[model samples]
Target: MGYEGEEIEGYYCLLIAILGNFDASEARFLYEYGPDHPVCQKILKKRPPPVNLAKMSKEEINQCMYRLFEEGYSKRSIADLFSCYPSTVNRRLTIGKKQDAEKKMEERRNQNNAQTDRCPEELCRGKP
Candidate 1:
């Protein structure tokens, strides 16, 4: 419901086309979490005959979570958005937030050091 107008229609159409006659909740869930998933793209591209989204497998969901994490959504945020638990999101991020945080910190430290190393001449010289 919070989705923008055009997005809502796209969500319903995609779900109806793929899954057939999904209830509002199912439609909503898929809308928030399904599209843009790499696995979903592959599945949609090469669906088995008599495609049934109700039969969506655990592997497909895991693949969705993998894609979501790769896009930098935090575990807690993903859980909240998808009506799952943090553990579910945490289970998906193989690289984990700790690694991301450490990398960010390292980059920040390097940037600070680089700034401090600027030549005094560069700092004090007036523009001509």
Candidate 2:
């Protein structure tokens, strides 16, 4: 059976998701020539979902946020992808930063304790 126009358009949307680039020129081309045109034939092919941002678990969301942040995506963009508010993203990022800082501080404290344990007499002698 042949695909209808709407089905073809849906395929184009899926293609856009796969390609991850739906610039103005591409939109104009698609609109001007329609999905059935020769240039759009490739787009008619189906592809799996690019990324299932929605319905992610808490751990997945944290990982996604960090990855996106590392990739230079703005908080707003990350929020949009996860279907949440920008403030939620911001708050999560803030909390993550705080936790990271605390972790580093704890590591440093442990290192200092180890050094002192290794040279208890030297440390007790103090600066001369």
Candidate 3:
């Protein structure tokens, strides 16, 4: 992986600078940095802690849920798309379904009220 330094076509390569020989999906590190590169070497020796979505804010969780639902994605697909745990996808789906149901109910109520109000004026007229 590269993390920082010289631009490769105007795009800074950070992974190439910071990370070396580490592939998460493949679960392996294939590069060996020089002894002078201490930061990359240390990162290799001690793996960094994984991000915990359970600690994320409600807004963040909602955003994930909406993306998954609106895009018609499966839990596993969403997990891979967002680089999160599959369990997180399952949890978000449940919450998203409830929220969607509530929204539909609210919309139905508003529509019904609008129709009733429109009918009242016509019903009041005797020369219909």
Which candidate achieves the best lDDT against the true structure? 2
Q: Model 2 lDDT vs. the true structure?
A: 0.65
**In candidate 1, what are the lDDT values of residues 7-122, reduced to their tens digit?**
87776767665564344654555466685776545434432223233666755556555556666655664565456798877775554445556768999999988877888777
Q: State the lDDT of candidate 2 residue by residue for 24-65, as single tens digits.
A: 456556666887998765433321224675677765667567
Q: Estimate the TM-score for candidate 2.
A: 0.48
**Span of ten consecutive residues with least summed lDDT in model 2:** 41-50
lDDT of 3 by residue, 2-82 (tens): 533323412323353335323432122222333346655554444333435768787566655675557555565456555
The superposed Cα distance between candidate 3 and the true structure at residue 37, in angstroms, equals 43
TM-score of candidate 3 against the unseen true structure: 0.44
Best by TM-score: 2
lDDT (Cα, 0-100) at 11 in candidate 1: 62
Minimum summed lDDT over a 10-residue window in model 3 is located at 24-33
Over 4 Å off in model 2, which ranges? 1-14, 17-67, 120-128
TM-score of each: 0.33, 0.48, 0.44
Q: What lDDT does candidate 1 reach at residue 104?
A: 83
- Estimate candidate 2's RMSD in Å: 9.1
lDDT of 2 at 123: 68
In angstroms, the error of model 1 at 126 is: 7.2
